[model samples]
Target: MNTNAEGHLARQQRVGTLIDLFAATVEEHGARPAVSDESVTLTYAELWAKTEQVASGLRAFGVGQGDRVAIHLERGVDLLVAVLAVVRTGSAYVAIDVGYPEQRRVHMVHSARATVVVTDTAAQDSPWDEKLVTTTVGDLTEATADATPVVAPVAAADPASILFTSGTTGRPKGVELTHGGLVNFATNAALPRILPTDRMGQVSSVSFDAFHYELWCAIAAGAEVVVMPSVPELLGRDPRRELKRRGITTMLMPSMAVNHLAKEDRDAFAALRVLCTGGDVILPQACREILDGQFSGEFYNLYGPTEGTTACTAHRVTADLDAAQPVPIGVPLDGCRVHLLDADLQPVPAGGTGQIFIGGAGVARGYLDEPAETAARFVDIPCGSSWGRLYATGDLGRLRPDGLLEFLGRSDQQGKIRGYRVEPFELERTLRNCPLVEDAAVLVHGEGDGKQLAAFVELAEDGAPAAVRAYLSERLPDFLVPATLIKIEQIPATANGKRDNEALREILRDDLHRRERYQKPDSRTERYLADLFEELLGVEQVGTHDDFFALGGHSLLAFRMHRRITRDFGSGLQLQDVIRHSRLADLANALDADPTGRPIRA
Candidate 1:
């Protein structure tokens, strides 16, 4: 990045605050569509009215400038309203997932030091009331119906939101973001070429940092916001119906979902003009499928961490990109400089991998309340200003000769499962609480296609697999739950007595390969399923009990398998169900029984 470009990009930060930016949009596109979901469509004017109404109630409830407010609700219009309302009060908002374990939720409420909580009826009985003053959307609306509204005085540097992510330690860490960093993203990086008529799909969780990009980037750019129906909707379901129904012109999705749409529902994304994917590295297969004249939309790859306040790099795919080479994370976002530095803070040679250091205004303030950890990650690099800092992304990458950064892999135990960041340490702590688990160790099981969490447990007594899975399901989000659980007398240790993660991974891999010889398909239906799995997974042989996902079948390939099964077997199976019944035997049984709606497990 040149000095001129740096200054130019840095100057792109123009907005005073996110509220003011969106207010300007509301003024310009008043009658145009703003945000919508399955239930309601709010024009820019209507959304502004609701935001003001909620902001007044928030103020009355004692939320003010510099105070942190927690929004505990699932994704919906009410959720978005509560968020904007909190920011409008000159206070930063924390998006708390309603599904988080009560223990996690309470920890966040106390840790964040939230002054007030805005929740819907779903969280009416939650512990939010015990810690802070709590208000509901309905109550806020009714209370402010007759009251005059006022916008609280806010500065551009004021913190806008706090998002909690898996920390290295057992406790979750809150990443506090400011309006300035967010404004930089929405203005210079996200949807830079966005048109007012373009519709942005909201698929990221309200709690995820990417939600800032999903919602704010569009509204700030004078575009419509289309929220996905639910988390399940964002999963491997047929996107054609939803895309057509919402008239979604743009969507920022995880790579696997993008791959699924292209491979299975090829025509589903016709309504989209721009499709952005990040979270995890996208496979070249996904890009090839989209670029092969299947989908006519532009496919963009976005890259950044919560520390960067959403994506700081974007690359538009081209047909000539090599499938064998690692997909580059693309060039740096405006105002952000990505440096490949060696261990001694020296720049690595071209094509040499190094720790990616992101510098600029895009870097976040730091982790909420964890100054030591924050300081350790955000190093004091030489910049022109007094605040010379850079976020040392633990991720390793290399600058290609073409100037694109190719992501290597993580240098630590933390890994991305599906699209969510999973910290092995945090997951292990959660597992220890389970009565079924007397001792536990979590390790990233595979790389690339088969990447997943594998938990090795030492049981107090014998424990049923389903019983343990059910318990973990209640306590952790679906993504955090280990895909495979193995029982052992004791976890393997190194010579120094520390747990050996490599040893555990080897144990799982050996066990997986040592399973009883592949059971051949007997019946015609079984043979048909086996043949399809072989074709989809590119495996020479597929056993009936073989887990589809474990056999390198991702949701994208699973959707392809689902389509093939439904077409050949006269079934209406869903890709979601196909993932649940992962093995050939289970899927065959599901197809033989009820292939319409959600299939019942045998």
Candidate 2:
């Protein structure tokens, strides 16, 4: 918790663009393995050559400074090449999620005003192909092999990437990040450094800011980047085996996955040399289990918003750390300043909770094409000796007497579900867009890993909850889709005409009791499954018809439960059985149908 003013200043003094740092790394470690997937491995020199070829292709097609190119490909070598190629062409890259709904993907591309899209999907299959130029990874690498590589002048303040995050206005806001911000993170000494000998795992979806952090940090350090499978798939299998097999030394995971893995397998991180978890509140129990178990590595809790780069602060977990107490978000990263201020924009008294304002080299260049919104969040604030720009993170926090920062949740309607930022207003807006829904309200419920979205909707005529949920599923990502949906006659409101959230919660509580009314387990299989559900989900008196997801079960937890069931019941009970038959009676029936089978190793 000690603030090293001199050290902080020294770390902030280094200035250069990502292009500069990556170029230097390539020269230093040209013979080392730079990036690899299951299919191929590319040395730093080979990666540089491939990047240069792709950059030449983009330049040949008129991509250069001040242009935005959308990269809409899955995570792998091609995705990495496309991003680097776009940056090499001196154009800001816009990442569009391949898994997002067509409407959402189109909105991101059109909203960013991208001049070209680099994707392998055919133009006929892509919805955003109209008007914009389309190219492929194969075309860029093969067609431009003989072309001259572009050498566009790079600057620290130039835009590098634009990442879209969930917004309360029902539209995703594009946060324009600069080369300086990314360089600041790569050069920051406060973080646990990734050595050239370490093999860092890349797991985050390309659309997320964490993807850039995972990729650039390792690239800048000349470390080996091992691109892993999707997060869900990794969690479903035993991660320790895979990590050890791949020789992954450093990685960052969502708090939900961290907690679940920590509990499911105490030796989950035995093979890792450094583990970091954030993006949501870290569960104390998970921290305790990991630190007390087989993880013999550095552990940290990183905190920040997309507007403040990937991470602004970090808390290192030590042997004497008390899991019972709230974990501090720790001190600001080098070159960063965290100010806790009141509503009047004045600094709050020491040890008082206030809105968190972050000022640092990592602060973003503001939202793209929205001057009003940009001015609202990013403002010029007082630094120590001079005035500097600060992003007003709506998150609330307080500095402890020991100088560590404690996160106190958000001051706005936005919430984090399984590490993904979600705004209930966006979900509500999407719900209202459905013809069956007359009106709707969405609220985040539960705590820690059990947190979920619950939606209440008023039907237009003979609308059903299932049909409305299906409608939302087609439009929103799986995480944004509400886990629990209920039909309501009207939205509760107070006398002041404001939506009465407390009343809505009360209704939700009552409805939960009515819908999942307790029914005693009728058979041995049912009783065993019921007890397991209660133990895993921390719910009391789970009924036969009670659904797992409604009872606060998620994919990671489902994987853990699946392992336990397979270990005790039989291997015949596949992981999909738990998801498909989430009800207690239904799962019990599945076990009965396939009673005799081999047991799966835990």
Candidate 3:
């Protein structure tokens, strides 16, 4: 056989589909622990048995090939079982995060045409449609079937899952991922090697693409999957204690989390054998700190979008890497291709910047039920000897002299906030539809972790900023909601009728000056917090009552502050405390009220 043919045959024999690879892993590692959360741990054999039972239950309920099952359970062993069960029944799973707004969940289910939703028992009374089959994880686990359900033949190209991403139309688009794409990614050699003895922490939300990285990649290599605690628990808890307690050897954390650990506990990742992070820009200083510390693990900076699987490229951060510039995105994975092309779809000249396009086995099938969008993004391009499809990432990047890919910002209005894709048009449309708003425009402000969504609203006569914010909070996810909502007489427009973002920024500057008045810190607690706020927000002379959000503080920054408070103040303040009591004075008061009367750090 030729080289390509042999590789194809080898892949088919080993992992024709994700299910096949998983089954093989189960057979080899049956006695070993496969996955565990705080509630339960399951060996590979036990996990397979549970998955079989759920698959049988699904088959009995008339779910079969081509069906899409919505999995809305929280992060746990049950969630993993439901996903495997759905795939085993020859159906695709649609992930619906439990924390999503009710309206958003409804839209996702309706858009994906999911007739069945599997949720936790506690969520049985949720507002799912009466006509849909709404079953709980408990029901599936306890279900009895007369005979074992036969496994359906799964094709490599068949859809494995549909992930919802922010869309310009104000509704999320379901990006269909194929079984082949996932299998290719899980087994690809270009990724950081996951050892069988490694215990990888599953931190990403089920709806997030990184969940695949945390679960599939670990399980495929016969590694133990350790699901971390919820967002609240993680933020308040010390990083060094938790990772050590869990015996976590590998973790794919977000860049924000990595940076926080680097700042607070440089040796937090000492127990980890492989530490990989991505989703946002990796700060050079943060990487340097970790590398310089007691962390003896392999550290990598990953980069990719949902359209190109979880991660397309990874750059290992060594002690010798240049600390002057942002780390390169590195080269494509074994089964993937990265192309930097100009407007005409031709490759950019050497060392020139162009839009990044991803092509290969990991490229998604495209948006479900949206042919126009699929055609627009997933286009046929000339490969070496044949025509192949490539997803136009809309992200700008350039090839370095060493052939490594360096990332630039987006080529379009879309931006990434806390690793989630943010479409300004989507936020603007939601704002315009608000009952309190007459007109609205949304723009991204600041850079990196300080980046936040700012909405300029020309409100109706009876509308108020507070009421408008509440309206948006009710409709959109916390990440999607604007951090700053400014009342404007009208949204500025250019002479050519385009939204004049420059003019809007000038108005924002004037508004900031009008609202903010410097008041020096009075107490020791207040002064300490003021210093942190100034350092985090990249501003000086912070007023005691100045709003954190108005000063460009975002969720990531808030998380970092939460960690710092717990460590420095010896308080039990939760992540919500930092956000709810955003003012410097308010936060100081909360910290003072903490029952733990340990003195603040020097």
Best by TM-score: 2
> By summed lDDT, which 10 consecutive residues of candidate 2 come out lowest?
1-10
Q: For candidate 1, lDDT tens digit of each residue in 308-406?
A: 988878788888879887678888887777888788877787789898888776788889999898989989865333445789888899887887778
Off by over 4 Å in 3: 1-9, 383-385, 566-576, 592-602
Candidate 1, residue 218: Cα displacement in angstroms equals: 0.9
Q: Best-fitting candidate, measured by lDDT? A: 2
User: lDDT of model 2 at residue 107?
Assistant: 88
Error of 3 at 91 (Å): 0.4
* Model 3 TM: 0.95
A best-first ranking of the candidates according to their lDDT comes to: 2, 3, 1
The lDDT values for all models are 0.78, 0.85, 0.84
- Alpha-carbon TM-score of each model against the true structure: 0.91, 0.95, 0.95
Q: Candidate 2 lDDT, tens digit per residue, 29-139?
A: 999999999998999999999999999999888999989999998778888888888999999999887888888889899999999899976642587757888999788
For model 3, residues 188-268, the per-residue Cα lDDT tens digits are: 776788988889888777888988888889878999999897543565566778989999999888887777668777898
Candidate 1's clash total is 0
lDDT for 381 in candidate 2 is 74
